[model samples]
Target: MSKQPLAPSVADLAPDDSILTPYDYEHLGTYLNLLTADAEVTDWREVSRVVLRIDPAQDPQRAWQAYSSHLARAMWMSKLGHRHLLGDIPSLH
Candidate 1:
């Protein structure tokens, strides 16, 4: 049987967003995990398997690249990407 579709997360922002990829809809948790791991200065290989579910033992290069790219995007979200998250801002009365 197929898995149930997940509901969209609040972190899945698109307001003024242009750099989003298909992974953005599904991997918000992974992004947060990477952000937290970055704060902790954790190992990427371990995070790749544990958070990204891409085991380096299976495909080392793909796993490494996936982890690196996602981590960078996660950092981007923690920085400039969040500015676009609201999509549109309403005037505060």
Candidate 2:
């Protein structure tokens, strides 16, 4: 089985009102992880190392930014992105 390729990281992002980037599509799994971690109130330091691949000891700001951004994305996915998937699948013909 083939897996989806990862998305390229961007220099800046926020908890915006839209999900229109390839980053958004590619990081769905990461977002899910972040969402789960957030719901469980996991530590950001660990979430950073595991999910965002950042070392909080080396750089705290970027790590936090990545975690929070993806957490917001996870919320967006749960609230809105799923709506897009509801009817997007097509039967192979």
Candidate 3:
């Protein structure tokens, strides 16, 4: 029997048009990491430039909301990873 090739990962796929630029994705990933590390820290002024690059008119309220949502997702993923590490859950294929 022949084995089929594995599909590409999500990162391998092109970003959506709304998130086309590399800067956008990079900032997003950084923001997610930081959020996961410390949800209380909200000093995103450092990434203001990156956020502006993606949408100059991005409002602070919207940005905070988006960041919060991203943080939640990251936290959930981290918890899952911890569970897998502890052998409470199977490793994700």
Off by over 4 Å in 2: 1-3, 6-17, 88-93
lDDT score for residue 45 of model 3: 43
Clashing pairs in 1: 15-87
lDDT of 3: 0.39
User: TM-scores of the models, in the given order?
Assistant: 0.68, 0.73, 0.37
lDDT of each: 0.66, 0.71, 0.39
State the lDDT at 36 in candidate 1: 90
> lDDT rank, highest first?
2, 1, 3
Residue 9 accuracy (lDDT) in model 1: 30
Q: Is candidate 1 or candidate 2 better by TM-score?
A: 2
Q: After superposition, how far is residue 23 of candidate 2 from its true place, in Å?
A: 1.6
Off by over 4 Å in 1: 1-18, 88-93
Worst 10 residues of 1 by lDDT: 7-16
